[model samples]
Target: MTSIQVADQTFVAAAPELAADVVGDRASWRRWWPDLRLEVVEDRGAQGVRWKVSGPLTGTMEIWCEAVLDGFVLHYFLHAEPVAAPPAEPRELTRVLADSNKALRVAGKVMSFEVKDRLERGRAVGAPATARSGTA
Candidate 1:
């Protein structure tokens, strides 16, 4: 019944609403976190998206994009437990949970860097921004 918490954030050179669009695109999830399956539990418009997670892990994940002076702050959180139980030993369960949490942290880090790279790379090279406000 214990939940592991994974959290991380990065800055992106895009507006909050634009960052949310990049984060909410389901087609990019697999490319970002291939081992995890995510379904939107709620979309917080310019704020971000909350998701129900399944696959190697089971629980909730949230990605928030906050507007900052320079651009956007992308935050990620994962509160979850391993889908498969470890060996019956209590210590084994603890170890498994720790390992899962570590993996989640790495995944979050990777996703954030990838997102930042994608969002900022174009801007760095003078390419026009592709991200647009979710609302017309």
Candidate 2:
């Protein structure tokens, strides 16, 4: 079986709970594999989530999403054999790996941004409004 591994880390300027929600939900997870159908296999709080994805490429991808008190990290491992023999050229393999890494990085950034926005909105709503000087 062929294997691929990729990892990315992001610092969320938000609380751990907010960051965890973005990384743990099904809707958010689907964004990573827009072309594939991903079903949640397991979701344990503060630990990880596993997903079974099937499409033109069929396999299970387990994403161990952990949230430290400071930030969040995602580690992914993909295992599958090509439907047909892969091109023998080394460049072909390299290209495939690079593309996969790029996709993961993009996904991580989106998740982090969403969490930060959510936290900022929550904070704004909770804070008291300040009166303008001499305007009232």
Candidate 3:
């Protein structure tokens, strides 16, 4: 297992295709993961994207859009280790993992929430899906 492993899922009351549009933007990848350079490993259309990542860390990352009742359950994962040599001390590795965990978690939430809010527009909590897209 990598020293830093992060997995996050968010339920967005928006259709899978809509979510895919935002998450699959190649240009936006720079903004979403500024520290990592991502090369497409798989482009799964409405399903999502998998990337071979390299930069501060090296490994695979993915955003999977799962169709649920009303919308997509976005699953985000990052399994990577530092690109540099492994830290010599366990304490240093732990600290790095903790910090990376926070930063990555926040980044994932921001992306998911952006799509949720934009697509769902003024949807009240517990409101029914109202996206006008044909699939919705």
**Highest-TM-score candidate:** 3
Error of 1 at 35 (Å): 2.9
What's the TM-score of each model vs. the native?
0.79, 0.58, 0.89
For model 2, the stretches where C-alpha displacement exceeds 4 angstroms are 1-3, 46-48, 58-67, 70-85, 120-136
Best candidate (score: lDDT): 3
Writing each residue's lDDT as its tens digit, candidate 1 over 91-136 gives 9877877877887788888888877887676564544443554632
Clashing pairs in 3: none
Candidate 2 local accuracy as lDDT?
0.54
All models, RMSD in angstroms: 3.9, 7.8, 1.9
Model 3 accuracy (lDDT, Cα): 0.83
Question: What C-alpha root-mean-square deviation, in Å, does candidate 1 show against the real structure?
Answer: 3.9
Candidate 3 residues 13-128, lDDT tens each?
87677776778888778887888999999999888999998999889999999999978898999998887775679998788789987898898888777767777887788888
Q: Is 2 or 3 the stronger prediction by TM-score?
A: 3
Worst 10 residues of 3 by lDDT: 127-136
Candidate 3's displacement at residue 24, Å, is: 1.2
Error of 2 at 27 (Å): 2.6
**Residue-level lDDT for 20 in candidate 3:** 67
